[model samples]
Target: MSRIVILAEGSFQFHAAKTAVGVIRYSKDTVVAVIDSTKAGQDVAQALQTNFGIGIPIVRDIREALPYQPDTLLIGIAPRGGNLPAAWRWQLLTAIEAGMNIVSGLHFFLSDDEELRQAAEKHGVMLYDVRRPPEKKVVANYTPHRAGSHTILAVGSDCSTGKMTTMLELEQTARQRGLNSAFVATGQTGIMISGNGLPIDHIICDFLAGMVEEMVLDFCEKYDWVFVEGQGALNHPGYSPVTLGLLHGTLPDAMIFCHIAGATTIDGYQHCPLPSLPEMIRMNEDAVNWLHPHHNSKVVGISLLTHHLSEAEAHAEIQRIEQETGLPTVDVLRFGADPLVDAIQRYFNA
Candidate 1:
């Protein structure tokens, strides 16, 4: 059995740690332990109950938790303002000295922080700064109707967020509009689609050469519109660039980009080592410039995944993105009945 210890101190780290546990729950080889210094000597049992409603004990220090001999120590602690804390730096060193492989979602762990990053690398540890692949349980019995045209509203953030629920709601919205829409689980996990209650197969695995073209062509022949949901995090393994490439090749009539706006979005840009959002917009412009020569499809608009944001905050974020990128942005939640329905109608018309 492989033991994995998650070191969490702050609220955000605690949530992220729990999410990681959820992602790896199916693995029989993994055992997870949560460590928090503030809660030391207290009943790990009781603390877990209060914090996460779990039975895992919250040990006070890493040394006390070391008896379990975890093979992997996942550091859920992040540096304030994107800088690793001095104490956490020492704790990571201690973990390595204790012979545990370390993994972290901390930006510094993933960044070019030479001192700490190099130290961890020297210990032969794997530092994974990437988001965990979404854990979607497949409903094997779910078989979608073989329709001629179907619209799939796959919702997920470019980062970890409420993509699943957004996708589900989009499906509901489609159904309300009298469109035969389905929620497709292109992510690694399977989700139950509304209406038909069928399981949206993960196209990453199920799709073969020409399979996408065949599916799209068939759906167009049978259904009025097909709404395919995109996955969260463009870099996630479950997020197949190839799938997006295929969609582009097949020439979808319209494309909608969903952006999840939360307090995290403000700092997300700092954590992302890739091109900034502005750069991405520029790249999109360049790509559009080249692709539009042969293809003809409009980038319908950007939708905000506002699961927890207030109306004002959501609107502000949308406005910011619109102002920055010169692309129309809509708050998916605020669009409500009239605007969402109208957008759907207009999308189909385009």
Candidate 2:
């Protein structure tokens, strides 16, 4: 596994630094340090106000991290529009010049950029653009998945609502319980963790569903259970298409609705109010049923993200949501995924 130094720079909050957080929490690779000049001297745990990267030092720049002898620099934020920030260019080049591989999840392909690509070649380093979609094109095959296959998708109230985290925990818990489970990744962070999945958001719009279908089908061939990491939200102005593609292509037998507790509106779009939980549930289920009435898929559980809540508060919110939606609700990470797993099993076994 690579020794990673995450580059979050100016954006290092909980939501903005999701890539760095995800890689630290889930990746087997060692995260030696993090780069965020503003938070210099503080560890990632302190900066994020979470325990994810407990003792890892948060440094000021690429040069400061060189002493750690990190072989890789991971671009640790998926910025809006997925473009590489011009300010980060010199940091990446410096890393490359020092023979450190660059792993970026940006839509701007570092490998395709002449300067960076050439620098990488000259230095005998590599640039990994995880968001680059596969070259092949195939339309989604609208058909039933194989018999005995069970799939559950994570849908959410908005982006960064813990969809991938929920799905990942579900898969792990299911596997630990002796079930043959697979996690189908659909985003750059998920890909970084699972090492298998299309950057569905970067794939051509026409082939997005097809790409998802192929991944689900392949996993379903082997695993009895498939937990797909979802992207975006049904009501998101920018990301609804990716959400719909996953819904239609995977035809999940069950869905987990994810939401950050107490969130009133979409992050970065405060003017756009969020739908009521019940209404969002209705919209998601309706979208699926309207497309494939045969699937009879439903939101089987709620994965409420309560990282901001106290333990007591998190429990209270979970209970309140359960009473409101009448579905199994859990934090998954804070608590456990047993309730949601039970819901999926019950839904499928029924």
> lDDT: which candidate is best?
2
**lDDT by residue (tens digit), candidate 1, 182-273:** 44433322211221222122233333213444444555565666655444444334443543443332344444555556433322455644
lDDT of 1: 0.49
Query: Which pairs clash (backbone N, Cα, C closer than 3 Å) in model 2?
Result: none
Best by TM-score: 2
Prediction-by-prediction clash tally: 18, 0
90-179: candidate 2 lDDT, tens digit per residue: 999999999999999988899999999899999999899998889999798876787999888999999989999999999999999999
RMSD of 1: 11.7
**lDDT on C-alpha atoms for all candidate structures:** 0.49, 0.91
